[model samples]
Target: MSTLPRSLLKNLDLFRSVSEHDLDTVLQIAQTMRLQAGEPVFQQGQVAENFYILLHGHLKVVQTTPEGEQITVRYVMPGEVFGIARAMRRPTYPAACIAVEESIVLSWPSSEWDHVIARNPQFAFNALQTVGQRLQDAHTRIKELSTEEVEQRVARCILRLVDASGEQTEEGVSINFPITRQEIAEMTGTTLHTVSRLLSSWKEQGLVNTGRKRVTVRRLDDLIRLAEGQPPGGTAASKRNSVEPL
Candidate 1:
């Protein structure tokens, strides 16, 4: 049996509606896992034996192409449930989930999925809601990739990260995590060189402050304007300078 507090599960979105009795039932099956940065919780195409709910820290879901290139699909925050290949009726996971920082997760055997849902209606509802939201996000990403310019995509990606994990600080709104330019490239479907150059230009224009694996938005309004396809400086020449051939 897991030694973690029972109240911890209650705080998670997946278990928020579950009653005390149902929570106890879930705790009986859950196994706690600790992971270091760069460790994969599950690899792409692995048999999905367990579904997990992150208790703490961040993770990134990545999919590898046949040509061996990796693309980041999304970032997972605490309280989010993941790795439900069984629920999706898939034999194996479609992507890999890797810890972006030191993290903790609670996992239950895939075999127990039906039993748990059969007994806990609220949990079943919550699980379905989670799956629906993810599908919507995936569709949104597909749309962005199909139509948006690289510059707009990069700006929008940063904004999404900020929405997920941004923290207010003396240095404006900080992303509050270690995210490298290469990872940003993967998320935005651009080259690392392109992300670096755009960031450098934004910095010179006093829109952001960046360091190794860190980014802080100093001028949120200007960045939003750029993301919306408007010139940051409200001029035609500024718009021309903002976009470059990839």
Candidate 2:
């Protein structure tokens, strides 16, 4: 009871159509879990046994590279549904989900999915929507990777995070999650050195202020300009020099 995430029907748009009784019935199949930061909720290629709804805190989706390097695909915020590999008919997870901080989730076995969705049509709709969204996000990332340079991709990634779960503060707009330069580099398909150097340059130009596990955009417009290849207060001559490996 206490484990149930703030009524799913209220927080998740896809579940809005489900009645409390229906929602509760589905939840009856759920098991609540608390995970420590850095712990894995699910590993890549593991059996797909459960579907999860993040109750609190954050999660990172990661995939392994050919060289055995782990690249971050995306970050999940609270109230989102994840671990839907069964919905895709995959016997194993394609990627891993790890907790970014102490987090809670409600999970249900894949075996119960049909029963749950049949009794709650909205559940089926929502599951499909969630999977569809993952496809769209992947498509967008592919476009960015092919069309944008490292700096632009990194800038867009930061802005996307800020837009997703940022909190406005006296300092500036900060991403409301624990993120490291290595993870950002992985997410943008670049090297950590590149991300660190670009961030250092941005800080000097007053475009952004970064801290441990936090990034605050001081000039979002300028960052957007930079992402579009517009040199912000810096000339074209300096742009190449400012962002190395361009």
Q: lDDT for each of the candidates?
A: 0.86, 0.83
Candidate 1: tens digits of C-alpha lDDT, residues 1-246? 679888888877667778888789889889999999999999999999999989899999999999999988888888887999998999899999999999999899999999888977877887898899999988887888899998899999888888888887766788887899999999888899999999999988877789989998877767888899888763555433442211
Stretches of model 1 off by over 4 angstroms after superposition: 233-246
**TM-score of every candidate:** 0.91, 0.89
Error of 1 at 2 (Å): 1.1
Colliding pairs, model 1: none
Worst 10 residues of 1 by lDDT: 237-246
Clashing pairs in 2: none
- Residue-pair clashes, model 1: 0
Q: lDDT, candidate 1, residue 192?
A: 94
